[model samples]
Target: MKRVTSLLILVTMYFSIACQPTLEETNSQLREEVIAVHDEVMPMMGKLKSFEKQAQEKIAKLEQEENVDEARVEELKALAFDLNKAYDGMFVWMRQYEVEDGDKSPEEVESYLKEQLVLVSKVNEDITAALEKAERVIGA
Candidate 1:
């Protein structure tokens, strides 16, 4: 009975291991996901800059107007700051990023890609949030 149980355990372990994705496959998938998130948000940097410019112009115009709302001007300034920070974050990440070479081990590649995935995803979220906030403020 014990021998049978041991054999079953070994077979189960083998099947489980076989079902799991290889490190290279995992790395490739992670790399693709990271790149996808980055590509999705990259073009938004330009849009964010344009919005910032518009907000700055609005603030400037408000400053020169009679009975201008200082609170509104401050809100626009805050929105522009957020947009700038988000845009700069992406640019800096791109500038500092190094492409993984074939010489890297599968484990190393996977680790690096996983880290990048987190970073890219966060940047995407930040940019999206900033854009949404800007739209809300502008629409109001």
Candidate 2:
């Protein structure tokens, strides 16, 4: 009975030691992955924040101009519609990253996300131009 008990203890100790490294390795990999994700996501968040600030400034200006040019209202309406469509598309692109981040490999997902940055930047440029044109019309 004593030998059986001792043998059982030794086996348990061996298994525990053998299993520990696998768990630690998995934990370490997950930590690295999380850090990588943060590195990628933080910059994009900053860009989005800057874009939001610019948008807010434009909207404030637009509100100030609302009473100035009653005649340009139709043009403003079209610009607003275009702007909304562009922004909705941008939101969808961002959401796609959120959905695919875990399922796809990081490199593959990031490549696709990079394409979205170009598209979003282009849309932002278009919106900026439209806002500027609208403001000019309002000022006139």
Best by TM-score: 1
- Evaluate residue 105 in candidate 2 and report its C-alpha lDDT on the 0 to 100 scale: 59
TM-score for all models, in order of appearance: 0.84, 0.37
**lDDT (tens digit, per residue) of candidate 1 on 13-91:** 9999999999888887888898899999988888898889989999999999999999999999999999899999898
lDDT, candidates in the order shown: 0.88, 0.53
Instruction: List where candidate 1 sits over 4 angstroms from the true fold.
Output: 1-15
Which digits, one per residue and each the tens of the lDDT, describe model 2 over residues 60-138? 5666883755434455555555545544554564454443356665555555455555555555565555545544533
Candidate 1 accuracy as lDDT: 0.88
Clashing pairs in 1: none
Q: Which candidate wins on lDDT?
A: 1
Worst 10 residues of 2 by lDDT: 41-50
For residue 40, what is the lDDT in candidate 1? 96
Q: After superposition, how far is residue 83 of candidate 2 from its true place, in Å?
A: 3.5
Total clashes in model 1, counting residue pairs 3 or more apart in sequence or in different chains: 0
